[model samples]
Target: MDEGWDTVEVPARGSDFLQLAVADVPAGGKAEWLAGRLRQAIADGRLAVGSRLPPTRVLAAELRVSRGVVTEAYRRLAEDGQVAGRRRGGTVVVAVPFTTTPPPVPDGGSGEGGVPGTGGPGGRGAQGGNEAGGAGSVRDAGSMGAAGSADVAGGLGWPGDPGDLTGPSPRERVGGPGGPYVGQGAGGPGRPYAGRRVDRPAVPRAGQGTPRPPGPYPGQGAAEDGQPYAGEGGGPGGLFGGEPGVEVFDALRAAPAAVDFTPGRPDLTTFPRAAWLRAERTVLAELSAGQLGYGDPRGAPRLRRAVADWLARVRGVRVEPDAVLIVAGTAQALTLLHPVLRADGVDAVAVEEPGSLGARQHLRNGGLATPPVPVDEEGVRVDALRATGARAVLLTPAHQFPTGVVTSGERRRELLEWARDGGLILEDDYDAEHRYDRPPVPALRALLADRVCYLGSVSKLLAPALRIGWLVAPARYRAALVDAKRFNDLGNAVLPQLVLARLMESGELERHLRLVRGRHRRRRDAMIAALAGHLPGARVHGAAAGLHLTVTYASEVPDTEFAAAALAHGVKCQPLSWHRQSPGPPGLVLGYAATPPGVIAEGVALLGRALRELT
Candidate 1:
C-alpha cells in the first residue's frame, strides 16, 4: 500500500483557448479574474505583437461566464490600447505595457528603488500598473491594422485626447461605479455596463483622436528593413564583416553623424503617402474573409500579377505572372535560393571581386562557397568568372552596386552565352529606375529568362520597410524555390501586398517613380558639384545613374580607417572596402538621395576635411 504514486492532476476546465486557473480567483470575482489574467498575459509576453486573441463569445463559453463579462474585459483592454478588435481578424495585440529595470539610484535622491510603497520597476505592485496616471513609461505605438483608425495620441483605441496624459486609468474607469461588475444589477442576459449608476470619468470613443497623415511606420529608415545604417563601428572589420544587408544599417544608425551619404537610398520623404492611404482603404474595404488568413508562399496572386506587369512596362522585362515568386526582398530571395542552388550540384558562386559583401555573406552563410572574380569598366570580367570555374554567379547588372556601371552590350552578350553554357546568373536589378543620363536598359532576364534568376524589389523605389520583392527563376529551379519560400514564414503579410497591388494598378506607383527620379537627379547633381568643389583630387565614379557617387583616392590608406575618421567628423558613408572581396584602391561610397542638396554639399565638405587630416 506504501508503493503508490504521489501526484494528482486536476480535471481540465472549458476549451483549450481559455488559459485560466479557477482556484486563483475569489468566490465572486470572475470578471475581475479574467481581466487580470489577460493583463498578466500581455505583461509577461505570453501574447506578443500581431498575436490574436479568441473571440469574445468563444472565450466566454470557455470560461463558462456570460458573454457580457468577456466583452467587458476586452473593452477595458481596448481602452488601455493593449488590444483592438478587427472586423474579421479578431482581437489582436496592439501594444504592451512598457516596463523597464530602474536605473542606478542617483545621489541626493531617495534611496528607494521605486515609489515608496510599491516595489522597484517590474515589481509585483507595479505589475498591475494602469494605463493612465501610473508612474511608468508610456510611449506611442504604431498602427494596428485596417480595422483600427489612426490615433494620434498613442496606440489605436488608447484612452485620452491628443497630447493629454492626465486622463484617468482605463482599469480604474472600468472598476469605478456603474462599470463592468462594480454595481452589479440584474440587467437580464446582456448590458454589462448598464448596472447601478455612479459618477465616473467618461470613456473615450473608439478610434477617437486627431488623425495624422499616414506614412512609413515609426522608427524605420530608408534603405533598411528597420535595421540601422552602417556606422563608424561597422566596416569590413566590424562584427559580421559589414555585411551590406540590414546589419550595416544597424551600425550606421548607431553613429552620431549629422550628415549621411549612405548609398542605395531613394528620397524616402517623397513616399506617396496620400496615394498609399487611399489604396489601403480600398483594399481593406474589399478584402474577402479568405484574404485575412495565411497566404500563398509565392506571395499574393494579385501582387505577383501586378509585379509582372510593372516590370514588363517599366523595366523592359516581360514575363507571365505565374513565373513570379514574391519575396520579402533581395535578401530573402538569396536566402531561399541558397539551398536550392546548393542542391543543384552547385557548391560555389562566383562574385565580383569588388562585389556586394552582403550578397556574398548570404551565399556563404547558406553553406555555399563564394569565389571572387574581377570587375572592370565593361562590368564583371567574364574571362575572370570563367577562370573561377564556379557554376553560379551573383551580379548587379542593371547598375553595378558600388561603381554603378551599366553592363555593356558586348558584356551582356558574353554573359548570356555563359548562361547558355550551363552557368546560372543571379541578376540583381537594384536601383535601375533612377537613371539620369541614358535610356533604360533591358533587363538581362528579358533577353534570357531561362538562364537568369532575376531579383527586384520596391526598397529603392519606395521604402525598404515595405519589404516587398519578386524573384523570377528558370523553369527547372522554380518549384524548389517555391517550396523553400513556402516553408519560410508562410509568406509575407497579405494586406501590404494587396495594398501595393492596388497602388500599382492605379498608376500611383508610376507617378511616385517619376516624382522621385527628378528629386534624386537634383540631389545627385548637388553631390557631384559638391565633390568637385570640395575634394578636387578625389575621383568620382558611377555618376551617370543610381543613388550614390563612388570616390576613389590614389593614396594607399585603408578605407576603413578613413571612413571611421569621417564618421568621427559627424559624417557617415560606407567605405569601398566593405563591399569588396579583393584588394582595391581606397574609396568611399557616398549616397546622395537621402540628404537634401545643402546637406549633400556639407557632407562632402566634411569628407574633404577628413581626407586632409588623414594625409
Candidate 2:
C-alpha cells in the first residue's frame, strides 16, 4: 500500500531534475523511485559519467520531498558506485552504465558538464577526423605581429574568394615573396592607425631573415603600448569617459581612475605568480632545444589536448584535440572567422543588443556588418535574431556580458532549431569557469558542434597579458581559420601555450579559478550591499554569477554622462549605452573581481556622490 502522493513541483531555475517530466513517484517509495530512475538513466546513457546531480537540498525542494529523501536516493547510487558527492563540486556520476555498448551522447543533453577530455570515445577525433591536424601544422613558426593597432586586423585571406584557400595566402596574395609590407608579421594588413607603426620590423619567415625577436608586439614595450589611449596628459585609457566609441577599446583599457569598477577583469592582484613562475620554469627545464625555435600553428598539441580534456571535464564539450585551433585570443578567433563567414555568404552577424561593443567592432573590422537583436530576461530574443536576417549570431549564453542573462532552456531549444534551419552560432564562453552560484551549464557546442564556433581564453582566469585563447569551429571553417591564425601572428607564442597547457593539466588553472571565485564572490556581495545602501534606485542584474554585475536605474540622464561623472569622482566604468546600439536603460557595468570589499564600497559611495552631483 502506498502513502498519499505529494504534489509534484519542480523549480525551473538552476534545476538538475533531468527534465524528466516526473509527475509522481510512489509516495511511500519516493527515494527508491528516484534512485531507480537515475540508475536507469545512467545505464541507458541519458546521464553521463561526468554529469553532476542536483544538490540534495536543491533536488529535494524541487521534488517537494524532504532533503533526506534526496539524500537517501543519492546514497543508494553511492552504494552502487554510480554517483558520489564531490564536496563543493556537488554530486557527480563516476561510472559508465553496464550497457552492451556505450550510449551515444544526444544533443542538447545534460547541461551538467562532466570532467573534460575524459569521456570521449577513445579513438575518435574532435571532429572525428585528421585533416584539421594537418591544416594546423602549416605554420611559419616564430612569426610575430608588431605593436600596431592599424595592422591588428591582419588581412586574413586575400581579396580573392574567402573559400579559395589554395590560392595565395595574405603573404603570397598581397605581394609574392616579402611584398611591400613593413612593420608587419607574416602577412599583416593595417587598420585605422596604420601609419604610425612603420618603425616596427617586418617578420617574414626564416627565408627573409632570422625570425625577429618578440618585441614591439601589441602588449610588449612599444612607445604606445602602455598608453593605449593618449589624451591630454596621457591617461591609462583616454580622457573621454562618456559612452566610448568602438575605436577606443585599447584606449579605454589605458584610462586610469582611482576606484576602477570597469567589468571583465579577474583579480589580477591575486594571479598565482608563484604557480605561473613554477610552470614556466618547468616548461623551460623540460623543453627540448628544438622546441625553443618555432612551433605548431594549431597550438601546442599538449595544450590542445589539455584544453580538450579540460572542456570535457568542465564545459561538457565533446571534442578531440585536433579540432582545437589555438589563437592569440578570442579577439583573434573572431578575426579569423571573417573570411570564413564571408566565404559562406555571411556578410553580417546578428549581435545581442547590449552586447559587447568590442565584439561588434571586431566583426566590423572583419568587414562584416553587425545587426543588433534585443536581449530580454531570457536572452538574445530569438525572434529578433530571426528578424535580423543575418545567417549567423554570437552569444555568451553561459553568463552574458554586461547583461548577464543565461539563455533559458526554451530559448536554447529555439537556438538549436534556428541552427538546424541554416543559422550559425558563435559562442564566446569567456567567463564560464568563474561561475560562483549556479551549477555548470553545458556548452551549446556540446549539443550542436557542427553548427557552432566556440571561443575561450585564459585572459580572465590567468592574465590577459599572456594573450592566449582557443577556438573550436565547425569543420567547414576550421582550415580557413587555421590559415588566418598562421598568417596573423604565427599562432601565439609557443612557450606560453605550452606553459598554460602544463597549468591546465596540473590543475593549477582550476585551483586559481576556485581561489578567485571566493574572492570575487566576497567583492560581489560588497558591491551589492553598497548598491543597496548608496544607490537605492539601481536594480542589479546578472548577480548570480560572473566577475561583474550590471545595474540599471530609472534615470533620464544618459549613462555615458553618469560614467563620466563617476570617473570624475574617482571611479571608472562603462555605461550600458555603450553596449547597446539601440536605446536602453541607464546603467553601469560594474566589475567586482579586482576590487576589494572596502574599495568596492568606497567606489560605490563615490558613484552615488557622482550621480547626486549630476542631477
Candidate 3:
C-alpha cells in the first residue's frame, strides 16, 4: 500500500478546503502520513473537537490520492476512537486523542479555527455556516435538526473517549442511547459527508424533521370550490384521486408526509459512495484521449462486455458483448424501443392491467397504443394477450412491479411460445436481482433471445440519478435501436459508463447487493408484522420479492381515497389504481426498501390509521 512517498514530488497537491498537502508528511506510507497529520491536527486543536473533516472522496480527489488511501486513513481514525460515522451524517470527530501540548498554528493552515457560530479564526465550519458543531468544541444539534450533539468539550472524560469500545458511544451522551454504531454498514451505507443530519429540511425524511400536524398537506384534498377535486370525493387530488397524470407525479413528490412508501425506490442511504469513487478514479486515471470524444452509440464496449458477463453469471442470460446496448436507464430503453417497434410495423404494445404507468406513458409518447391485458396469479394472462391483438407486449416477467409475482414456469413457457408466434416480447427485468425468498428466474430473453428485447437498470439497486441501464435487441432491431439511442443523446456520458463497467467487473456491485438484500429483508419483515397487527383484514401481495409489497383489502372504498386518507394520517404511497388501465380491486403499493424496520412499522401503522378512517 506504500506509494513510495520518499521520492514523491515536493509541494504535492494540496486542497484549498483541507489546506493540507501531501508534502507536509515525513515521506512514508500515504495513509499513515495523512492519518498522522489529521491526528496531530486534532490533538493540537487545529482540527478542533467538533469541526468536521472533509469528505473522503472530496479530499482524495483534491489531493490526487486513491480513494482507498483516504478510506484507510479514516478507518484508522475511527479505530483510535478519534471519529465515528453518523447515519445520514458523515464521519465527525467523536473524541480528541490525548495531546501533550497545544501546538501553534502555522502561518497558513486550513485545519485551524473553524466551528459553527464560534467565529474562531475562519468564522466558518468546514462545511460552512451552521453545519459544523456548536459554538467552539461542540454543535448544538437542536439548531441543525434531529441529530442532537455530543458535548465532548464539556468533559474529556466521557465514557467512550476514543479507545474504550465497551463504553457508550458519543451519540448516547446526547440522548440517542447505547446501540450498535455501524459505520459503513447495512443499516445504512454511510456516505462520506452525506451531510449533517438534514440532507435538506424541505425533503422531510422519515424522522428528520419536527413533528407535523397529522393531516393532508395544504395543496392536497378538495379545493376551496370543493367539487370532490377530481370527482373521487374528499381526498387528495392530482396523484391520489381520479386519473393520474405525468405532472401529478411531481406534485406527489413535492407534497409533505411524515413517512413515505412510494414504490420502486431503493434505500438510497445504502449507496456505495466509496466503491463508486474508486471505480470513477481508476477509469479517469487511465482514460485515453481518444475515449474522451463522443463514444459509441451502442454504449462503451467496456460496459457492454461487463453487462454481458454480469448477466451470464447472475441472471442466467448469455449475451455477446457486441449485442449489448448501454442506455440511460429503462425510461430511455422504452423511449428508444417504441419507435423501433413502430418502424417494425408494431403499433400497439400490450401491458399488464396492473403494470408500470411510467413505461406505458413512454410508449404512448412515442405514438404507440398501450392495450391492457389482465394479470392473474400465474402472471400476465398470456391468453388475454392474444385477445388484445397487440403484436408486442411489455412485461416485468422476472418480478412483476407492485405485485411481486414471479412468472410461473408454465407462464414462462406460454410466453415463450407466444413470442415464437411472430409476437415480440419486451422484458423489463428491473427487480430480478433483489429476490430474497426464491431462486433466480432466468430472464425471458434468455429462453428466447431472438423474440425478446431485454431491458435492465440499476435504478432499483443503485441511485436513479445515475440514469444508466442496458438493453439487448434481436439482430433485426439492433441497428434501429442503436440509431434511436444515437439520435437520443449520442449515448450516455462515456465517463459514467466506464465507471459503472468498472463496478460491475470488480464484484463490488454484487457485494453491495448482498448487504442491501439483508437490510431489505429485515425491513420487509417489519412491514409484514406491522400489517398483521395494524390492519386486521389486509391481504399482502408481492411479499416474496421486490422493493415493495401490495396490500389489498375487501372494501368498496377506492384505493385513491385510502391513499389520500393515508397522507392525511402522515404517510405517502402510490394507490394501486394508478398502475391499472382497467380497474379491478383496490390496493396500495408500499415500499419497504427506502426505510429502516422501525420506520417501516410506523409508516404502515399510519397507513392503517388512514385506511380505517376511510373504510
Candidate number achieving the greatest TM-score relative to the actual structure: 2
Residue-level lDDT of model 3, residues 365-469, one tens digit each, is: 676666666565556788768765678899987677766656665666677678778889999988876754443445666556678888999999898999999
Looking at candidate 3, what is the lDDT of residue 606? 85
Candidate 2, 1-615: lDDT as tens digits: 211112222232223234222234456998898898788666755465666676576567645678998899999999999988878767888996566775544333332332221112221122211111111111111121110001111111222222111122222211233322222322243311111212222333321211222223211223332332212233422344322334455445666678988788988877888988999999999999999877888898989888876776557566768889988788888988988888888876778766897897677667666666666555667876776567899899877776666675556767877887898999999887765334445577876777888999988887788888899987768788888888877777888888898877665675566567667766776777787778864556666567887776655565666777887777888876567554344678899888778888899999889888877
What's the TM for model 2?
Answer: 0.67
Which of 1 and 3 is ahead in TM-score?
Answer: 3
- For residues 326-349, write the lDDT of model 1, one tens digit per residue: 999999999999889877877767
Model 1 clash count equals: 8
Q: Which stretches of candidate 3 lie over 4 Å from their true place?
A: 1-235
Structural similarity to truth (TM-score) of each candidate? 0.61, 0.67, 0.63
Clashing pairs in 1: 228-249, 228-250, 229-249, 229-252, 230-248, 230-252, 231-251, 231-252
Candidate 1 segments whose C-alpha is farther than 4 A from its true place: 1-249
Minimum summed lDDT over a 10-residue window in model 2 is located at 144-153
Superposed on all Cα atoms, the candidates' RMSDs to the truth, in angstroms, are 31.5, 16.1, 23.6
Cα shift from native, residue 253, model 2 (Å):
2.9
